[model samples]
Target: MKDRPAFGDPSRLTTGAKLFLILSAALLPLALIAIFATLQTSRVADEEARARLRVAADESARSIAIELIGDMVALRVALNALGADAADAPSCARVQGVFAQQAVDGTRFAVLDRSGRVLCGANFALPVALPSDQPIAAAVVPGKGLILAISGKRNGPTARAFFPQPFLATLGTPTSRSSGFSSAIVVRDQELVLDTIDNAGPLDRMETTSADIGIGDLALRASVRSAPVTSSLIVAMLLPLLMWAAAAGIGWFVVDRLLIRPLRQLRASVAAYTPGELIDPGQVRALPAQEIRELGDTFRAISRTVALHEAGLAEGLVRQTKLTREVHHRVKNNLQVISSLINFHARAAPSADAIAAYASIQRRVDALAVVHRNHFAEMEENRGLNLRAVIGELSSNIRATAPEGASSVSIALDVDPFLVTQDVAVAVAFLVTESMELAMSCDPSAQIRVAIKPSEIEKRAVLRVVSRAFVESEELRMLISSRYGRVMEGLSRQLRSPLHHDPLVGAYEIAVAVLGRD
Candidate 1:
């Protein structure tokens, strides 16, 4: 997908999916590596198995060969006796029987004469019986010690042949069986070599082998299943899987916790900041580590830059307000001299327009005086002005700004008991009182409502003034609108504040957001 908005997309991952992704990305490759390494280890185990089998087969082959060759050599002594050949026939038979008894296990000593005839002792059963014309029997040869190759295949039909002294335990004894191989021996060259067979196979399966020591049991040989050719492959596969599962689990838990988890937390923290809700150690509680502390310090620096700009604006307002206060004071003094001059000239003017103009000059001067009077009068020890006191004085001063004997210009103060800066209090009271005075001049019967209330919705103080005075007249409306913006802005600067205007309710609101106050 090229892109899809996060809010509505079905494919977008939930928290669980995201965490699984984190785990897989960190763990899966490690699992692969572990599996490969384990397989390598398993190959070593397999090699050892083959080596153990080789050693066992070699030991059994050599042991069987020695037993058979020693038995065949004894047969030579019995044949060499001259008296043993004549009237020693019964003694010869007894001697042969005694020697046959000495045949250890599968080693059945048969004394075959020069004609391959079973003369005095037992014949070992060949797996396949040989014809009378055959030179070598299943495990016997014509000459000296030689091997009767036992095929890896199961032996064919077998028959039991008894010795003069039979092996009592027969085929079931420990000496009868060998590890991973089978054994049998038979007499060969009348009195010469015997032969032993480890494994005999069809011509193709019998790996052609040469004998080193020319004993009666000529050669030792055993066939081992080739590596990777048996069912051991399944073990090879399972060994790696088991080792990988165990190792990958250990790696994921240890490495992810030690390395990946902290890095992810840091990534989330970095992404969470908005324009206003940036890093606040007061909020996140210092991240709790030396490394995160350094990161947080960098975040704090960015936060402080915005704080500093806000502080600079506040400081600028303080300076602008101080300068404005000086200008207001000088204006007040200049207006006072003008008011005195107006009073002097009112009697001198003959026309009614001239007298009304002089009275208007005096009223404007009194309005300016109301601002000065509010700022200078009874400032609090905190160097801040009280909104209540300023409102009270402005109401009282309105009586002064009124036409002669018009005490009917009643004022209603709905202000909450909220405090403000001295310069802000003075400026707001001046503008509001002047607007009320002008409304009064336009309509003598006008009922003015000046209200100061804490706005629940806006979470600030609001100033609302409404007058029906000359509301239809373009001149009075324009004057009201123009001064409304200027008054609120000037008051905000004077108080080092931000103002919100609500034209719908005819309200001007100021947020007394003084830092360090809270």
Candidate 2:
């Protein structure tokens, strides 16, 4: 026999469950790959944003450095021109015109003597001390701005330029607002020239780009805040999730329609089928899958084959029942004919003994005829004769056929209802006839009684015959011991029990136990 699925075994999974599992197994790796790709893409995007910010900061620093170097060079040339002319008024006005022409907004230039005294400039102050060897230097004055001091020569003269802090704010790239990076420019060893700290709000970390302005003393540091996560990054991260959900939905639809639904329909069809009923091939062919359709076809073929065999078996059973009934009918008719012939022979017998013998043979033949008649009657219904009915008929017949002188030998029957096979009923009928004949032969006026009842403990049926006028006659004993001994033995063998006899106080009793149908 084929092995059955255990409880909770995966092999017993329904079509839809199996389909869902298969789709899930197939999509799992693809989903993982999509998620991984989205994450990597987001990372790359953040890195690009940071790289752009760095590039912008670096470019701004280079531009600022070039501008600062140009300013310092112009300052040195102006200082040299002023030194060549004199510290007179006309030469001073000419130097002022040069400074005015070269200066941009938030820029201030001043000429200072070797004593560090400001002379021909705006927004400059005399310093308490000056560096002897430093060619350029910067300072952050409180509440003022950034100040750059450029020496004309070693301690000869110096030019000072003051740039307000707001000028440094313009150095950031235009994309800073969208990129979430704040820009700042700071002078080395001094205070911040420009700071976006207030505008930037909070800073996680700082990224800086620095450049030396080539004026030997000034360096510009361009700084910006790190890039924050943007909406594009969020969209990138969520894209894979959306794709996976959509793919799962689509997979469910496709697999359920093309595979699961059809298989479910096929399962329902097969479950609904009953034995001996026709299976429709059209319904089976409606499945979309080729292999499943073929399977349906195979099932249809098998069902058809089974139906054909059932039809043949039913026809054969009908013919056999009819043939059996006809055979029993013929046997009963032939036995009756033989009984009639014996009765006729008895009527024409030469002597009293011959007539008695013929009568006895006629009665026995009539008992057999009765058995066959009951068998024929039950054959059409596929059952046995009712035991009560058979016993009643047999007793009546035997008493009617008794000799003229034994007409007073009345038989009483108290038999229970029993259903037995044809062979058992026939054997029982013969046994009853023999017992009745013996009782009548013993005494013409004998009171004979036959009874059959079920034995509860032994699980069998018991038939008993009792006669009150038993004489213990020698002829009766000889008949039992010699002529009828084999007949009684055969009936005993049929009943699967011994024939028992008892002679007791004015009564002779005989009983046999037979296996019951129930």
Candidate 3:
């Protein structure tokens, strides 16, 4: 067992989703509140402004009607007193002064001399053109203080007003300009008394149509023309925003504190990982949220499992080292015994052919032994087999044992400087020797061609031993495809592969896969 390492606490975990929800919860209500507040405030302001305008309209209508009636009555009296006599001079003066007073009060008054001709102060009147109308020379007078107006109270491009009432009325009956008494609304110009509080923004925009006032016509019998201030609209729009914001805020709190923060901590641990280094989730806090707390526990469990796995892996590696050294020692001893046996046989042999065959056997055995020797020489940490040196030794030995004068039968190796497993290298060496001996026997003049291509794809070195001289031999083909092939096939099957052989135009090839390119 390896010594355990300490790990940090797992409290800080923030996921994007949780953070988003938090922010949304915090701001959603605020935004909604702002929107609703703004909308309702605007509505209240509009209603208030309209209401003010309506009040102004009502005041102006009353004042205008009073002035009109007073002016008209005085004018009629003045006309009646003009009997070409000086008897009514003071009366005429008083009446004229009253007319002047009415004029000074901003009432646009005119006395028509039966032909609708102006006969009073500010005498320029052909009464200003009415909206959709001509001044009613045709209209009959109703009773005294009877004010008439358009049925609708719409404001057009001109002043909107009209009144038809008894102008004389014996000159003594006091008349009022109140709705249903003396005054009414008209749409001809919309406002009978256009009282702007010292001229403001365009009066036209402020002007409301009869439809805007919830009225069918331009008539305003008793009410003001403009809208009234409404506090109700403000309250209506605010309620929804409050509910939404509260919900949003709660949601945010749940997501961030409960979910996001803990996940972020886990992510940090994952991000800071290195290969083979087990993370110990030591003393991790119970996350604020259930899911995050569970996740932390899960991560801790994984870490514990990882630590155990790492310890087992380390022990296995140590055992592998010891096993490798022992294997090398045994292989080297066996190879030495074989080499000694071959040397003894060669020295005592009566025939050169027997000596060569024994030498061939000895050389292959030595090749296997040399590979094992390399393994035994190294420590437990040293792993893998060197194929180049092994192959070269095999080739060199074969050169030494072949018939002394057979210079034409040359041997060459095309092997990469790679490492392979010991079993694979030993198999490869014997296969090469067998293949070369078979080729030499066929031609006695053939040059052996061998290639050791390390495959990056299969993660193995493939040894393809080819001989151009003995490429088309039926016996060699049978041995390769049947007998020797079976031995190689078993090795290949152990490595989870299949041995492959090919007869080219000028070469008989044996291909075997060995582990490792380098």
Q: How well does each candidate superpose onto the true structure, as a TM-score?
A: 0.37, 0.64, 0.53
Model 3 residue 94 CA deviation in Å: 13
**What does candidate 1's lDDT look like per residue over 387-463, in tens digits?**
66666766665666466534577656776655566455556666576566666666665666766666554435656
- In candidate 3, position 323 carries an lDDT of 82
Tally clashes: model 3.
22
Q: What is the lDDT of residue 496 in candidate 3?
A: 56
Mind giving the per-residue lDDT tens digits that candidate 3 earns over 137-187? 212122212222221122211111123222312121223222212223444
lDDT of 2 by residue, 462-504 (tens): 7878886444567667877877768878887877777776655
For candidate 2, the C-alpha RMSD (Å) to the true structure equals 8.0
The best-first sequence of candidates by lDDT reads 2, 3, 1
Q: Which candidate do you rate higher for lDDT, 2 or 3?
A: 2
Please report the TM-score between candidate 3 and the true structure.
0.53
Instruction: lDDT winner between 1 and 2, please give it.
Output: 2
What lDDT would each prediction earn against the true structure?
0.51, 0.70, 0.54
Summed over model 1, clashes come to: 7
Candidate 3 ranges beyond 4 A from true positions: 1-258, 271-275, 280-294, 341-361, 374-387, 399-424, 435-508, 514-518
Give me the displacement of residue 329 in model 2, in angstroms: 2.0
Q: What is the lDDT of residue 154 in candidate 3?
A: 29
